[model samples]
Target: MAAERVEKRGEEEAQTRLPDLSFVHDKLQKFQSKMVSDFEQRLSCMVEDVLQDLRQRELRAHEFPNFEKSDRKSTWHNRVTNQAPADVSDAPNGHANGTQPRPPLQSETSVRKQRRQLPEKVFVARESYLTALLQVEHMRTIYHIFYIILVMFLLNVICYDYFVDGRFDLGLGTFRGGLRRLHWVLGVWLLEHVFVLALYFAFRGWALVRHRLKPHSSLQRFWSHSCLILYISSQLVFCFVSTSLCLKFNLPFVSACVLLLESTRLLMKMHAFVRYNAERVLNGKAKKEDAQEEKEASGRPFVPPLSCYTYFLFAPTLIYRDSYPRTSHIRWKFALNRLLEVVAIAFLYAFIHERHIHEHFGQYGLEPMGPSQLILKLFGMMLPCAVIFLCGFYLILHSWLNFTSELLRFGDRMFYKDWWTSHTYDGYYRNWNVVVHDWLYEYVYKDMYTHVFRGSKVGASLAVFMISAVVHEQVLGFALQMFFPVMFFLFGVVGVALVFLMRSAPKVMGNIFLWFSLILGNATLISLYAMEHYALKNCSLSNRSWTDRLLPAVWRCYN
Candidate 1:
């Protein structure tokens, strides 16, 4: 009985031992597979290194022609053969020892090279000069000074108005007047959005249609070009019609100008989108000829997703991309601060208009004017004009745009560069509005260089300046409801001349000159325009002939 129990216990032990044995076997199989994978990876790395060395050797051979070809071949052969260890060489079906040839390394190397050459489409940290500047104590102090000055100006205006008129008006009446014209503004704004959406969809749909058609067919090409031309024509017609209606109805010209500017901005963005995608599509088609190419190599279809396009429409950027670097969370405090700044700036602007601008130019054009009075007026307006210019810059380019960018989590905050420190007019122009500058650089200047001028940088630059000047003049003309070429001549001619003149000046002197020129320019623009505006308002234009009306009231209103 005892012997039987012992044998039964041994059999039970054996049965338990079977699971342990199986587990050990499974672990060994996994370990063996891992080892094989690790070995293969190491071997692949060695092969790449060997290939790179061979390439280096080939390059050296070219540099030193005295190196014999036979010596080079021998060196290459020895290096390749010795790259593998004896253990690897002895393995069954191993590639070493000349039994099996190594796989072609060209494709893998090419892929790696292509990846290395790919452009980064996002901003790096600390890329925005303004954002960085705002962090510095000195710059922050300067900003605070400006804010205090603006507030003080606002208070002075309010007190002066109260003392003179015996009323507690804060210029809300002007605001109310603008509010009454809000419908016109809203209508135009909505129309612009609708037009942009329509254009986006039309472009996307056309691209899809082209895809379905035979590749490179004349019908497809003709239709695509025709649609593009028609779209451009429609945009031009919209601008003219909007301007004409504003003039005819005597609508709020400022609101009309805003609408026109917004429309132009959207049109430019749409053009960029179409142009960028067209190139992408062409490259994709070229890559698609090779069946073995990766899908990414063939590139994305020309039609961007609607969600992306919509986001881009509101994004504080002119360059369109499917995706951008996004912040993890919205900084509500920062956004609110910027918005509050905008409000303060708006109030300051209103105060300036009521006090300085309306007080001086409220009556008429350079009437009863002597040389002394004209000079005094120009000098007096300089500081106010500079403040206005600064406020305008901060409100639009920095605060408002930054607020939008933060809300949207747009990572790139470089809407403008260090334009304040610009030593040349060209530099200032390039840095003043980076968003617009980038668009001009990429689309207008580059296109001119590539297509129209055939690499004439001067021609491309001149073309860009002309286009910018014309657009600026159009905005100014529409806003003021006057046919003024002051902005055009200043920006296109004087600005261009200064760019070359200041190009070689000492940095400190150039910056001083830049500020001086800017202050003088702003003062001149504001004074002259204000005079003309009030002249037209106060003077009897009904008695004037067509030629007289066409001429600036500033020039002949005194007569």
Candidate 2:
């Protein structure tokens, strides 16, 4: 009886624990299998990433732009500028100085003889008077320039209508009434050079004084004065000449303004892109000692600045005018390269997290990440959105990183703004979304300074804002899949007005207003997010119901 009871107890215990053992066994098998799949997926993704890098490399190397064959008369290495005097022996370069004497005009027969006598002239590293200003170096300066332009443009336009004209149409017969008076008021002595001059002396003088308490070089003085001039001039052109032309031509004021703004913005970006090679690449590729110094100082392995360098890889092929080789453009090649990178990174992440997710699930194709794992994915989506939004906000916040990280650090933090609006404000936007900032500076502000307003800060500011608003709206629309960046700008312009007006007020009053603005700003942001999220969710669902349903099918196919 005792033995039977013991046996029965043992049997019961075994039965109770049997499922646990079986469960463990099944769990181990699932984990092993899933791990394998995840591992494979990771391998696949990595392979894809490498393939992408390789493809871009090959494309940029081969596709090079389709410039006319005649243009090939000047290879990058050869091609001498006509800087040299006419009767000189070939100084080392075999071309006399910077200028090469013009060969006599000839039909094809004489051309060959001249070619034999005078080889191509190359511009070597003549003394490194200045290193190429890489996009990274130029980004912040560019961004601030853009923001200044945007703000000035917005302010003038706002003041013209909301405050000056007050009303638009003249219904009754008063020749001097509504629209005409409004247009006059908007166009009138809205700008005078006196206050602008005061601003220039105060800011520029102070900057120079602080830098060295006395001007060291004519170049420094010239740079400061010109910078100030640019601000004033850009404002005048954007506010007066450009605006008047729009009215005279019956151009859509806002649309015309936006066009001016966007072109400059793009140009600014291209400038930064060009400068990157000037600053970082040329120096980086020079020698071993430089590479060691760059790594030690920057603490970034791989390239001198990995993120910024990536921009060149893509930008040289797609964005810049004369970069890369002609044979590189394969159809749909860029798209394929992007897809491959996505696969590699996705697979790598999934494989790493396999144990954390379902033990049995391996490479659940397109499986939505659970709460914990999802933050990274959400981060990627939100980052770009925030960047586009902040370009408008940069007009409002007036910082670099919230604006210009694309240039300084390159693509690494190209989509970040966390550093921009922290308490000090300096640390924030300065390096955050550098790419767009570069665009604004070179195309809008610098052009205005050197060519447009002749370095009038206020004018540059106005130009940048108009350009920034238009570009932001377009980029945001593409990113968020909606329209109304225009509305966003209206709100942003209002925000700018509030900020500047507050800055001008008495300290106590300004502080109060600033705090009030800050709180309102937070609430507005929350509201915008909720609105955008609701809109996106509804739209995505409406458009892709079948895909939502077929998720399981996708999983099966991938698995």
For this target, which candidate reaches the highest lDDT against the unseen true structure? 1
RMSD (CA, Å), candidate 2 to true, equals 26.3
1-559 in candidate 2: lDDT tens per residue? Answer: 9999999999999999999999999999999999999999889867876886688556534443322222333322223433221222213222223235565665886666444332222321111001111123444476456446445534544454456669532212122221233343333323322332343344434343434423457865666567557655754554445334444544332234343343333334333444333333323333245876766645221222333334443331112222222221222443343344333333322222222122222323334435454344333334223333444343322222212321222112222233432332222223333345444554455566656777486677667767666655543443333343444555347644553454435333444554444444544443343344333333333336655443323222323
Clash total of candidate 1: 0
The global C-alpha lDDT for each of the candidates, from Candidate 1 onward, is 0.73, 0.40
Candidate 1 stretches with Cα past 4 Å from truth are 1-122, 125-127, 285-300, 365-367, 542-546
Candidate 2 Cα errors over 4 Å, as ranges: 1-271, 274-311, 314-439, 490-492, 505-519, 532-559
* Model 1 C-alpha lDDT per residue in residues 1-559, reported as the tens digit of each score: 9999999999999999999999999999999999999999889867876886698578546543323333434222211221221111121221222223434555877666544331222332122455555565666788889878977986887788789888877767656654456577677778778878888788767766777677789998888889878987987887786667667656554466666677677777787777777776655433243556546545435566788889988888887766665666778999999899998887887788788887777765535777787788889899889989988888899899989988987766767766897789988997798788878877788788778988688999999999999999887787778887889999999999998898877666899999999999999988988888877877765535677657887765776
Among all candidates shown, the one with the greatest TM-score? 1
The stretch of ten residues in a row with the least summed lDDT in candidate 1 is 85-94
